[model samples]
Target: MRDDSTRNTIIFVVCSLALLLLYQVFILEPAAQRRQAEAARKPAAASNTTAGPVAGTLPGVAAPAQVRVVTRQEAAAASPRVTIDTPALQGSISLKGARFDDLFLKQYRETVDPNSPPVELLRPEGARHAWFAEFGWTGANVPGLPNANTLWTVTQGSTLTPTAPLSLQYVSPAGLTFTRQIAIDARFMFTVTDTVANTGAAPVSLAPYASVQRQGAPAHVGHSQIVHEGAIGWLGDELRLIKYSKWAKDGGMELPSRGGWTGITDMYWLAALIPSQSENVRGAFRVTKAGETNIFEANYVGALRQIPVGKQVTETTRFFAGAKTVPVLKGYEKQFDVPNLNWAVDWGRLRLLTQPIFSFLEFIYRHVGNFGLAILGLTVVVRLLFFPLANKQYESMTKMKKLQPQMEELRARFKEDPAKQQQEIMALYQREKVNPIAGCLPLLLQIPVFFALYKVLSVTIEMRHAPFMGWIKDLSARDPTTIWNLFGLIPWNPASTPLIGQILDTTLHLGVLPLAYGFTMWLTTAMSPPVGDPMQQRIFKLMPLLFMFIMAPFAVGLLIYWTWSNVLTILQQYVIMRRLKVDNPVDQFIARFTGKSRAA
Candidate 1:
């Protein structure tokens, strides 16, 4: 007879290695390629791509736009601009097409360093990796309608501020008078009121439309799976998400929605258009090509209106382009009557639990003033809530441990009769009033909460660049300190060594938090009832170590939460084991330590 334990252990190790290889091949490799690609590209570089306005194929939507890639300086020099200055924003609006093409976030930085450059949100078209929002009228066979090249002169204010708005005016050769009034709040919302009059001899037909366009996708941010970076919208009581990969694979999406918003979102930033609440509009997430680059656009075309001679049409559209802060999104959702604006955070299918978890975490952070401490507080509250289930789980584990010897004896007596051995063991369990599967109830129940907490920490902007004590500078990121470099004590960069440096960094990132989590996990696993099958027991014993490596690259905030939860579980289980007179790892360790001390 072969030893199944040895075979299983070998199989487990191979499977673990296979998983790591797959992770490297997929997640790690793609992230490296994106980072490398970003580093290689220069914003000032020019391209030979020809571009113009996008004309929608739909009946009412026309005068489509084109794509151009040019230097940032050329973009600025292309047309005169109205400056935008606010508490949280600094950028310019191009007088050409009256587009918001250049913007930066004032309060946020590209890195944790205070002196790092501010985050760039919207950049001009023809600039490398361009992202901007454009609003105008699209008309069928209406030559006088404004296009991207039509230059507008400022009619109201030169500088757009929270207190002062900017109004631009453009007159077509056919005697059409168009005016756009743009206002920005202190934070991220942009309100635009567009009015056009038909001074032409005859009536002209046109439709109002707004679009947020990105010339290309940016580098991946956060864990790509958990953090949404693509098209998202809440239309007709449903939140729709189309990820970038999926968007690229599946060409375009068009939905006829009323009073809804659609936008392209990064992990922490968003550029969205909220159409007027009064009218029905067709919202779309579409992609176009520009010299090998994919241009993504989220746009809406409202109902077409006919303007009689000397008559005018006015419409209001709101655009949000800035940080995806929860409070800010929620405020806009209520104030502007936008439906499910907060859903931009990618709360996932477990939103029922994730949303409240994030809210409570925010509340705790507000009171304690530290997010790391706030997570610890959350773990304690969760443990208290699940105390009863945990107690029952521990009680069941203790009973199972006590029945181990009798179970083995039954197996030996009925070795030749496998069915009889199982029947006898079940009878023994019934007599002892032990529910065999009860030991896993508490852990199974906590899985959803664990996932919810991970999602909150991973996706929320408030947690980005958040710090804990010691070496943890960013809770949203993985721990920076690595065991390979002796936690930076040694003057060496493991990631600069050679071709193998990155592989080493990814595979062996044993930081203090990860190590602590592994130790606590092992302790809790040790307290659990030993498995009856030798093969199962050996595989179970290896699980903690294998999972430690798997989780080592995750956000330290998540590791802190799990480690604290494990510690609390251990304490509770130890107490239950002692009260029930069951032998446990804690008491055994203490006794052995005391005995060795006496002997010494």
Candidate 2:
């Protein structure tokens, strides 16, 4: 029976590893290559198709026929644009439709390369994958109320900057004058104050509406589950996120929100429409199909106000278009009363653990000037925090190691009497005052912390292009140096190898860091007492190798933290074993390496 159980355990482990390899080769690698290929195939010029008819657009509105496919430069130059220059933003607001379609984040870049272009937040309407924020007034029984197609005239500012706000004006033939004041802060928030003056005799009822619309889906959609990449909103104090696929399947969804915001979010960038806190609004996440394109929109409309014959009322709405940095989001949440704006970070259900871990990591990184070092420091802090519990657990393990001889004897003596062997083992344990489960306590406790750190590393933009020691340019990415190509020393690309290229490069391409992790894990396992069953001991011996393969594709920062943690655990166990005078693998390893007796 024991032999059969051991065989089954080995079989299960082998099958799991096989399935993992298959999944990486057949699913993950293929999907990644396909997405990259698609991005590469996209033309620089916008397609003949238009990304028009966004939110606040009238039903049955027809897109223009000429299908103006132009470059971003042509799109920006085709219409007069107001320059948007700020510490955090650089772009132009198109005067044609008063749309913030040409915007770029000044801080972040497309790559770590200094010459790479800054991150483009919003692109021109006629450019590929066009995205922008458009706000307008929708009035009942009122025509020509400045819809998306309406061209507005810039009134005051030549340039929109943090210190200066731009004003735009549009006068309807019916005698109502619409004025828009666009103001931006030092960070990512943009506040638009719209005022409509009733110059005509008749009163006009208008509902202030805003929408953040993205044409088609992202080039690389459904890329991450850890970070939200679709329609997100906070309505009625409840935060919501709907993926692009979900939106397409569900058609549309709406929630009544008072004083909240809704928008489209990328992995690190966001464009949200914030309605006034006092105004009751209806938020909707809608999808519209035009030909082969799907237009995604997050829009909200405030309560309609009746503008009297000679009186004008003002309505204020906010727009956020920038990186989803922690400080900026929190600042906006506090200053503008944006509800649950931090949800933009996608903290997951473990926000309680993830938030603190992220804060601690960021705090350490600021002082250390290295994100990789910060992760190492964070691991040390975590280890110290759990030192007391781990000490007790290691001490118990030491005691168990001391009883190995007696346990072996009992097993031999009760070879035919299994029940008596169990009884003897329990008696021996009670005599030694060793809890059999103590070794598992620290591991169980670290699971949540491990997942929290993973969440932090996966979602935070600060770690996106962070670097570590030699050969590690981006800690957020997998180790680029793989042993299969002699750590990139050889003039060979494992990924370009025919047939099994991706599978070999992704799974079997061992990195220096992963090898270090495996070694530390092996040492930590070696210091522990061997299992009573020889087969079980053999299976346990393979755990380090199995885990090294499993974690090979994980982020380098996580691998660094985990490897450091293993080293710390081994050191702690060594100390406990030495103090308790228990036989351990550390002494043997040291003596073997030094060619001297451990006592000497």
> What TM-score does candidate 1 reach?
0.90
Across 156-201, the per-residue lDDT of candidate 1 in tens digits comes to 8889999999989999898889999999999999999999999989
Candidate 2, RMSD to the unseen true structure:
3.3
Q: How big is the positional error of residue 587 in model 2, measured in Å on the Cα after superposition?
A: 2.5
List where candidate 1 sits over 4 angstroms from the true fold: 1-68, 221-223, 592-600
| C-alpha lDDT of candidate 1 relative to the true structure | 0.81
Please write out the lDDT profile of model 2 over residues 92-128, one tens digit for every residue.
9988778889998898889877689999989876666
Segments in model 2 whose C-alpha atoms lie over 4 Å from true places: 1-52, 55-70, 496-498
Query: What TM-score does candidate 2 reach?
Result: 0.92
lDDT of 1 at 260: 84
- In candidate 1, the residue pairs with backbone N, CA or C atoms under 3 Å apart (3 or more residues apart, or in different chains) clash, namely 51-67, 52-65, 52-66, 53-64, 53-65, 53-66, 54-64, 54-65, 55-64, 70-126
